[model samples]
Target: MNNKFGLSNEYTLAKVLQIKHYTRTLFSFKTTRPSKFRFKPGEFVMIGLILRGKFIFRAYSICSPTWHNALEFYSIKVPNGPFTSFLQKITTDSSIIIKTKSTGTLILDSLTPGKRLFLLCTGTGIAPFISIISDPETYIKYNEVIVVLTCRFSQELRYFNYKIKQLLKQPHIESHAKNKLRFYLSTTQEPYPYSGRITWLIKSGTLIADLNTYTLNKRDRFMICGSQQMILDVVNLLKSIGYIEGTINNPQDFVYEKAFVN
Candidate 1:
């Protein structure tokens, strides 16, 4: 049923716990999790604010791991954009509404068992992988987890790097993530040793050379999230290499979510 805010009962209110600004355009916020809420690591939930009795919201991939006490999201501030413009002004004293249900194809359950897991993302698409990498179950599911993140600058990568290091310090997760997690960072519009789109890097064999692993193994699994064009490029490349897209009902070798980026 609809509520006074013209929202369904599926939504619940939560106070913002903290907000971290990575750069002028990038930020992340944590909201108190509903005690009864439950979600897998890579899932996303709708979060928004209600104004003038109308709902203004967007689907955001959860950034923090499930083990964390609160729900976290990484977002890009779009000047004058409908939701984010307002979101950027919120403080810890403010509250946001979150949909109780969460869903996404990037969760571990969406792919079949594999020898290795590859998470390829660009920009804010790294949110889901951030959660995936912090989860201990990820280490148990695959022999190794490879993350390829491409950004416009190095500062964005630093946020992700710090998150990983923090997770590595977590008692139950450190041992697992430390042993199995690996990262390859690239910047497109900035000066860096590894600078370029990840898809281009993969196609050019530069990614493989840097990682020292060439060719996709038959037992390798993939989860990609990025710009629509980036997703298309990676999907076509993976398909050419014999990887099959999958769904939760019938797990396959790969999956992708374009929700995070355009």
Candidate 2:
């Protein structure tokens, strides 16, 4: 891909080994890794490929943890989407581009000390939380890690459910997240054990019951990722409950990032 605009910085084409559907169009890919590359969990890198002399680029979160040798990415396959149209056709052994530098503001360091950690996500927004929750640092810093994922169907929940279950089973990590780690799911389109939009769930008190916990407090740190509306709604909820926005320059009670979608 041409980087004439200086938008492309890193060059990588690890072969795709696996792909699976999350929802109708959302999917996840497991790719081969470059041995020399190292990146912080939760950061996003600009990815693109050259096709017919033109390059298409997009930012995707590195969903795998630092400890894993392989790289993982979760994405939405929009019909006729500039990148997704081509990306969805990928299969095992397919090569995809990845930049060298992965950067973002969703890391754990963005928050101050807190006993409760809340990871609020919707759609592909869950990407970063997947990385942070797997990392040992998350459990080491917080007494509890509560992840609330909002999606339209249960299929999209598979990857996250598997990861959370696996992480909870690891003896070394279990102790840190035993009573600490929790997964709260809200399905909007399909009926499951639990169903509704996250905003509705939170407003109607279902979220509290799902979490089996009390309202958010100052000691609780939060991270939100989703669409513009979802982020705004969640932020409003946090504010109504007295949560402050956190940042690297000046730490506060919560952190957030807008998962890019076009």
Best by TM-score: 1
- Show the lowest summed lDDT stretch of 10 residues, model 1: 1-10
lDDT of each: 0.87, 0.79
lDDT of 2: 0.79
lDDT of 1 by residue, 1-262 (tens): 2365566678888899999898999899999998789999888898878866678879899988887889999999988888898898889999999999888878788798998998999888899989998888899999889999999999888678878778878889877877678889999988998889977888888888998875778899999987888898899999997889998888999999846545
Q: Can you write out model 2's per-residue Cα lDDT over 1-262, one digit (the tens) per residue?
A: 3255344345766788889875678788888776587877668877776666666778888888787778888898888887898898887857877777678878777788998888888988998888888887898899888888988888888878877777777777676666667888878889888888777887788878776688756788988888778888888987887888877788888878744522
**Residue 151 C-alpha lDDT in model 2:** 84
Clashing pairs in 2: 10-100
Per-model tally of clashing residue pairs: 0, 1
The deviation in Å at residue 127 for candidate 1 is 0.3
Q: Specify the poorest-scoring 10-residue window by lDDT in model 2.
A: 1-10
**How far is 6's C-alpha from truth in model 1 (Å)?**
4.6
